[model samples]
Target: MNTTPFRAGHVAVIGRPNVGKSTLTNALVGAHVAIVSPRPQTTRHRLIGIASYSEGQIVMVDTPGLHRDFGSANATAMHKWMNKAARGALDGVDAALLVVRAGQWEEADEYAYQALQRESLPVMLVINQVDRIVDKDQLLPYVAEVTKDREFAAVALISALKRKGLKELTRDILKLLPEQEAIYPEDEITDKSQRFLAAEMVREQVMRQLGEELPYATTVEIESFEVDGTMLRIGAVIWVERNGQKAIVIGKGGERLRDIGTQARLQMERLFGTKVFLQTWVRVREGWSGDERALRAFGYHD
Candidate 1:
């Protein structure tokens, strides 16, 4: 007879910008460890979400999208930092999931695939956003083109928005993890703290609500987090690169910021299971995204 414990190990989710990496992480872990937005580069930091099962566990690492740096004059410091963070997470991981949109493969996907090929580990090609595909037969050619020059342990067709084909993907992932004991408590959903999640919650609203108002220069930081009884109090700062961006975020009469706060606070209440009091402040940081010290202070790790 063969006896073995549950399997568990880190699996890094990698792909180009706006390819549903964060959505897949949330579905795999059954919790929101990373923020999702329609705009590209929604995830700026590396996040860990843990999922435990009777047979094994999967620790999912959601990283920023892979963006190449050619050392051109227009390459910002933040872009380099984010790309480094994503590629660095790939090393020393048990497995990787390369997510891509359902339709045809683009050059961005090729860039991400090239990055995954360098890792000497099992990589699963995740074809996401199938719900958007009108004709199912069209997927065949697309799949062939995507896998033509690449090698993958497995490929899964999934619609992260509709939550389809996730079970099969999970089953395949369970088999790839190393056989070992659980790395975290069974009930734990993620390795991140409530503070980091709260900050991300605020950032999500900013990205989703203000994608047009502020496309590329906005980040959130939690100034204070206090819990007492069934109530939680949090103060956050929204840093913008320019004063005009700050005004746009705050809006006339502070209406826009209030909307962002209301949405973020409601999500936090659901996640924490407590009434939340959240205060938000917007300020102009003037090139913080390009400043190394500011990026570190905002929790950007190499």
Candidate 2:
């Protein structure tokens, strides 16, 4: 057999909604491979997290959280459909990282716990948001409860916000990984393209600025992306459900659009390491969510 000191494999990070799973995946990958927000159901699909090391590489899959409803088309009618989509991300993972929030586990946690019970895969129970707990003693009990599950290879407490214990957690993940050839080239960090990433960064900025139902109802598509010398020219369409929403996004004299463009351009510049000129247009796409063709055209459903 061909021998290399370093090994690589996929580790799935699964948990309930809004449990800092995306943040932790970003921290572990050493870049913004996945988007993070305080909003639940922020992640819609399985995102890859790659960690490079001297001995091996760890590819972490940050999955959409297991929940009753994911605010998608199947949200109310067939929740099992959403659950199947969430669980599909866990298949064939070499290891699993279970992210649990500190303090009392909620009813949603049971869904996650039961899901884990069905898996024989090696798991690492991660206690996220440790900074929120004022007393260190209060943390131990929950950790104990998680360890009792017997599916866990180990239990860890960490604060994704404060970036505590992430190094050790990284080491633990590496240790649990099975010896396999690197699935991805060492230089490649993510599966998404530059244009897709730019669109996501803009969407994230819009979510932060607008908040509420706007974040849920809005979607961004990159109409065009081109680089000329040191400047990056980008065109994107922001789709909202109703005419009023479009008016709100555009604002008077296109003021809000300007705000969105400015924030997105700044972030994109930092990410691409070049100056960016971003142009955005707001369009009302009624029934876009239910229209499969519209979803495909916007690159939402693949």
Query: Which candidate's lDDT is highest?
Result: 1
Cα deviation at 199, candidate 1, in Å, is 1.0
* Highest-scoring model, TM-score: 1
lDDT of each: 0.88, 0.78
On residues 1-302, what C-alpha lDDT tens digit does candidate 1 reach at each position? 53656789999998888899899989877877788999998898888888787778998988988866523457787887888788888877899999999985788788888888887889999999998999999999989988887899999999987899999998898888998888889999887899999999999999999997787799999999999778999999999999889999998999999999999999999888899999999988899989989898988765
* Model 2, residue pairs in steric clash: 6-55
Candidate 2 lDDT trough over 10 residues, lowest sum: 76-85
RMSD in order of candidates: 1.8, 3.0
Cα-lDDT of candidate 2: 0.78
Please give the lDDT score for candidate 1: 0.88
